[model samples]
Target: MSPVEPFSDDSPLGASGAEGVRALRVAVTRPLSGERLENLLRDAGHAPVHFPLTRIEAPSDPRPLARGARALLRGEMDVLLLTSVRAVRSLAQALETVAEGPWRRPEGLQVWVIGDATGAAAARMGLVPDRIPEHFVAEQLLEEASSWARLDGLRILFPRAAAGRSLLPETLARAGATVTLVEAYRSVDDGEEADRLVRAMGRGELDLVTLTAGSQARVLARAMRGTRPALRCAVPMVAIGPATRMAMVAAGLPEPTVAAPHTVEGVVAAVKTVAGGLQ
Candidate 1:
């Protein structure tokens, strides 16, 4: 399956050209990746704020992660699936923290990533993915898996966020694939950051809210209640993809303006597009 199609120049949310993003205060909700987005926004002449809604941490229980890593090393697993770049780092951390001596990935084991960013993360650790969906998303990853690989009885090791979507593993299991899902990382909401966001929203200091992950959208929604005027805030949510947009709606937040290419640059273009049209 191809990646979700990117947005066109004439995106539904009015077009904000390059000049439209000038001096706009954009609140970013991504954690470790927020810096990258901030840089992009700055390049576009928009003011970017770093307000991480959640923190990605190592799992409370490390045994499952260690076991999964050991299985892959021993060639007991056929595929290693990474959903996010953070997952790749977390997996490496789990392996080093749990095992002794130098850790080496087995040669025969195939690795699959959900997107280009995750694939780049894997490559940084010397683990190149055999396949990455043309479109970056769990559903697309599953589609590619079913189309290319024989899943019946195939053992796949999936290391992902603790609260990651269940569609990939659940669907793979139904297809008779022996999938082992382990939590390599955990996403915990940062109350202090949420408070700052509440304050910003209350004073109308925030011009735009960007949600890179679905979890951040949920956290932002809860934070909204602390604001003096919740519904009237004209701040538009900028979501990186449809999944995040869905989460925003499910949480009763305003419908987000979506980024089509689903990259940081896509997000900048989305900002320009929205800001351009809203002007």
Candidate 2:
């Protein structure tokens, strides 16, 4: 007998297995290095395809970040919101460049993270957050933080990428908090990889496509717009969060299978469950 397939011999939705045998193929669009998502897909007997859509680049001018580091050390901001681990790592590195000794974080500083993974990243830098919003999106974080009356006079520092929407900063400002938005990095579109992904989709060599951010989903949509074949078939789009899912919908894609908790593990689990159901 042939090797037993790990994926269930199931049909698409309510269809019968004899109608068609579903083969799993996953497209990874993020700049992930580990084998975590790939391993999960392979465990479900899916073909994992990696095509990074964006690349993270450090800021050319480190002077502003260095200044921010000094301010952070002096406890200039009452609250620090860390959105991604990459940002935290970059900020820590910038701080180390100008900081002396063991590098101690500000005392009495309130830190808030979007999620557990981001919180873990902050912890790695010896900065424990005082609060972590349940929802991992900017709007949710704003809503949750806005309920605190103590934030009235607080100065919040948000270090993130140069591009992207300004909803978070705007919301915080409306809630009576002085927000200082700092750019720590930038995300550049990898046109070469985007072209490759478009080709793969056109040839029907790709199956599942995972999007971690709204910007990435939009980028993929733009790439698909120029591809002949990708514009015809409706490929499965898996989003990491509600914001990404909304972005996918806005980009003219159907509602995607959304991951809960908006973490890497959540994304993997959601993909496995959906792929297994489609098998």
Candidate 3:
């Protein structure tokens, strides 16, 4: 992908002069989906660092998901909460393995998405959400749960990564809802890439770091902690959503620029805004 472009106005680092520009480093911690953020950062004249911390892995057994799909069709699930596009895509793929032709989403199913992207993913599966919260986090989702009061006795199906924080499930359970947690996928570490990131940070070669998800932020924090040079780098971080921003903060990384709306375009806009403010 092309590097992120600079802001239309002077960048924050640009105001600092050549020395400041040299110190402006960015490190991308996750695999970028589009070129908007990268292009914006590069245009701003900052050296962009691209380091993907984890690789997405499909589940070893699709049987559970297949069963979940069958249950969903039978109206066993009252609500479907999707937190990520990956979860939707993984569930769709799993469904195809056991289901023939186009599988229709059951009616009367209250669908809730954590964000717009996840909603779009659900739309791809021919399922539109009943509600979508503004903040793309489990806390936000829980707070918005009141909207589905009619779904009181509902059985909610949450398909997510195998290993992740239990906030969503725990919160739903506390809300007096039956939540079924399914491991749709997993994220595996990339050691070689982690090493490259550490070396790049040590050399002060990175410019802007982008974290698309909370899981990615956690992976990055772990990787950085393992290397002192990476920890000492002063690269600015860009979080795609609140959860990611929280992860960055919890990891004690430098304060990050959080994207509004929590979308890819929002992230790109945040980079441009931050870059411009830098000047």
Candidate 4:
């Protein structure tokens, strides 16, 4: 397969001119779960190489997700917050297990997604998100949730990664919402991929690295230190948002050029902006 392909008309970046945009050898630390983002990067004239960092899978202990599913079916959950598309799919499996049949979302329960991508995932499962944050970030989700006066006495179910931060649940509790945080999935680093990334860095093949999740940032740091001598390549990092950027910084990596609007298109724009400025 070609390392880079021409952007298609269906791609969001199709209409965007690719001329004069310096295409960097960008390293994406996650597998291509969706090709939209990668297409956008290519549309903006970048060669994106996927060096998978973490693999997403169902959690070992499924009881927490099962209970959350039961709560929803019992009409006890007022709102369901999904941070990632994987969470939505995992929750769907848990729901099927709990219901012992095809799961139908209970009426009167609101669904909130982190962004358009998650919303699209929910849509595939016959769900329509009640709310999508203006900014695709957890902080914005909390802000949006807090704006709804009815949340003061509501029950919210959040099924996310096992290592997810407690900020969402804690913030909701402070706002008087009863929140149930369930571990629906586990995101663990792929050691083989990590080694490959370190090797690539050692060969000085990557020009820019994009980290979308904090966990990915942590994994990348571990990979950089995988060799006896650390692979201290000076490639610029591009974080999808502030949280990921913070994680990268905390791991002693260089501060990243954060993507604004927090979307695939946004990342393309951010990279183009950086590239344009360098000329």
- The clash numbers for all candidates, in the given order, read 4, 1, 26, 0
Which segments of model 2 are wrong by more than 4 Å?
A: 1-23, 42-45, 228-233
* Candidate 2 residue pairs in clash (backbone atoms < 3 Å): 10-279
Model 4 worst lDDT run, 10 consecutive residues? 1-10
Model 2 per-residue lDDT at 100: 69
Show where candidate 1 strays beyond 4 Å. 1-21, 226-233
Position 139, candidate 4: lDDT: 93
Per-residue lDDT tens digits for candidate 1, residues 93-138, read: 7777656767787878888887788899898887898998887777
The residue-level lDDT of candidate 2 at 210 comes to 86
Q: What TM-score do all the candidates reach, one by one?
A: 0.88, 0.86, 0.81, 0.86
State the weakest 10-residue window (summed lDDT) of model 3: 14-23
Cα distance off (Å), candidate 4, residue 248: 0.7
Flag regions of model 4 displaced more than 4 Å. Answer: 1-17, 226-233
lDDT of 2 by residue, 156-229 (tens): 88888888578888877877889888888888887777777777767666667888888788778787775555
What's the lDDT for candidate 4?
A: 0.78
Ten consecutive residues with minimal summed lDDT in candidate 2? Answer: 11-20
Q: In candidate 1, residue 148 scores what lDDT?
A: 71
Better of 1 and 2 by TM-score: 1
